[model samples]
Target: MAKAMTIPDYHPYQQAHLNKPQLQFSDIAPLIEHYQVQPWLTVTELGRSVKQQPIYQLQLGQGDKRILAWSQMHGDESTATAALFDLLNYLQAPEQAAWREQLFAEITLYIIPMLNPDGAAKHSRVNAQGIDINRDALALQSPEGQLLMAAAKQIKPHFAFNLHDQNRFHAAGPYPNPATISLLAPAYNAEREINASRRAAMQLIAHVQPWLEQQIPQHIGRYADDWSARSFGDTFAAMGISTVLVESGAYRGDDNRQMARWLNFQLYVAWLAAIASDSYQQADVALYNAIPFNRSGGMKDVLLQGLTVSIGDTTATVDLAINLALTGDRRARIDELGDLSLFSAFHQFSVQGLAFKAGQAYPLNTALSLDTEAHLALLQQGYTHFSGDKALLQASSRLPVLLNPLRPTQGSPQLWQGATFLLVNTQGKVVQAVLNGQLISVPSGVIHNPLGT
Candidate 1:
């Protein structure tokens, strides 16, 4: 069916620089068709979404050890999908044909590239049925889940990969944003008993550890191994399949996830090569804990400081916090605009003024204790206190708060005054909707900007 191209020792980064694009489901179809070559290499439609879009499966290799890998379980998670595509392209290359040929000669590979095609197109987390496919692995309520489960049952691969994209909020310790990336050799059952299958999975992760560490050391982490009945990797591991969960998450500086994308491809290539080598007799599990813990670097896109706003009947100097979606440029992308919510918890601010000294974090739970010296510090930093009565709240209940009476809004998309409900292109500087109570500026440059203009 699909013709294999010739590629040399293909470097994943080089290929990514050439193939990185905001890919859609349609763009992968031709490539899929091109790879459907040979009697052993077969392609089939696993099922269709509610929208009637076909969910395709490509199978290569027919050996004793089969690896079942799926991508785009969350529609918005596309880094794994891109890595899978690049792997295919590399496998088809003239120089890399031997690797494909040798691997297929012994092992069978079943790939469902973009399991949630509908979600991939819409770039949402849930599938067409509004159910998370990962959670549905055990429930098997949605057709997508059923399709994947049925395929797993029929093929019963020795190993599996649950690929996804996590948020940028996760840090490599407690101070860095853009969690370099994390992996999980999911535990099975209530006790998290490590059986042969779990061991197999760990070996795989251990194998990729060297390559990943060399590329991005002091990053990479082991996800919490708590077992969840609803989670796919957990369920699969419980059922005796060694499922390795690969999370393609955020990277520092490169918000569009381009850096993560390239790392993901390299990781996958190293993983496949390791699997083919069958060298698992000497995997060191102790290295798992050595993976650095992600840190949170205090970053705020828009800081409004030292403004006397009326809270109920009292006028006090209030600070406004706006958390932005980090994408594209490190400064501020147009789409990273979000509503400023009221936060009543102790927030660690860069703190250079406003009743508070530098490095001082205040609990917004109580009334303001204004200090002119602190206020001057904020003003010097070009910090303008928020204007308007609407306060958007993003504080979680678990966060520490000194006072509770001044608590702000919570949950995703909480709205606040002077906060833009809609993100607009401020030419190049981040602009907001309802600016000064009216639409301001206009969009220019990149159209359909994925990293938010």
Candidate 2:
């Protein structure tokens, strides 16, 4: 049996090349210029985007086994682009000279740093023509798509890596933890058949999983195997090339995705090392099926349970599930308001047998804008809620009160504001209060004013 391969720790090799997760083609212009001067790298302008931005391909090594990888196919997904740059930096480092030499001797790499420059600049998923390049594989409608497919056909690479970024809400299997990284071995046909090419991809993925799991236990997810001909991975697999999909996802408290970017860098280095050593050939492909599949809607940001709520004479004990909105303001929204025993949350508050009462709403003064001092004063005075005109409420204020009420829609529940809640015990004593889905200390004598009198 072949010797079991061990991935070297590449954390120390991570450089500060990328200051932020969002990268425009202009942001990497200096690095691209620097690489153009390197003797080991050959740069070529493959094509131009709809916005007339140049798309360049960097070629390295002369080995027979070719590997083609592209980043930023969806302009908004930039984690892989950062990782690829960091990988290039590592290859040129003095300490990694021997390993880099061995990798070059075994494989040639062709990398497209930013395939959709226009989308990247605007931080959008689609290109300037509003075309999703990934879905344009079969149609070959976009210039970027045409260039990618043409390059793959000309190079006839032995392997391809399709890099992307998934939604931040996805979790690993049933675990409440966010999926920091996800992998996939795309199917070659509509039936989702696995051939030798796919088997090789799976084997490689199985090899990488252990290394990733060590860094983030129960936080790695495997993408669904549904086949889409329009997708480049599936298309490449159908062309008899082994393809691996790397999707960078959310990490707890990493709003800027800096941690995910570093993880991606580590993944690329380990994968390349494995490929150079030819250890992936011995990897157990069966382990691929054992990896956890990505799951959704299993967790919430906050859960409030066992509270007795009175909604216009309808009183019932219930639970509340809240999630942060994906867009602007990141306001907490009520996902469900019933039995949420099956769900888990990062933060949980239980107030069993406590009565929920609406707090008094103090109208904001039109002449004086609400500031942190004014907001805190109201809380100290036992006023737990506030309401005002849209302009007044929209102003920057540090008040812990809901500003508006959101109604339930067909797809999502209404995210309401201004209706603060105070939970009280049977003795009419204030126990706890929630303002704008945030826990706040309630003062005495504030529990009896359920009608906001």
- In candidate 2, position 248 carries an lDDT of 90
TM-score of each: 0.68, 0.84
Q: Write down the worst ten-residue block by lDDT for model 1.
A: 351-360
Model 1 agreement with the true structure over 169-211: per-residue lDDT tens digits: 5555543344567888898988987899898888777766766
* Model 1 bad stretches (over 4 Å): 1-22, 37-40, 293-321, 326-453
- Of candidate 2, the 10-residue stretch with the lowest lDDT total is 444-453
- The residue-by-residue lDDT of candidate 2 on 130-205, one tens digit each, is 9999999899999999999999999999899999988776778878787888899999998998889999899888
lDDT of 2 at 39: 89
Alpha carbon lDDT of residue 98, candidate 1?
75
The count of residue-pair clashes in candidate 1 stands at 48
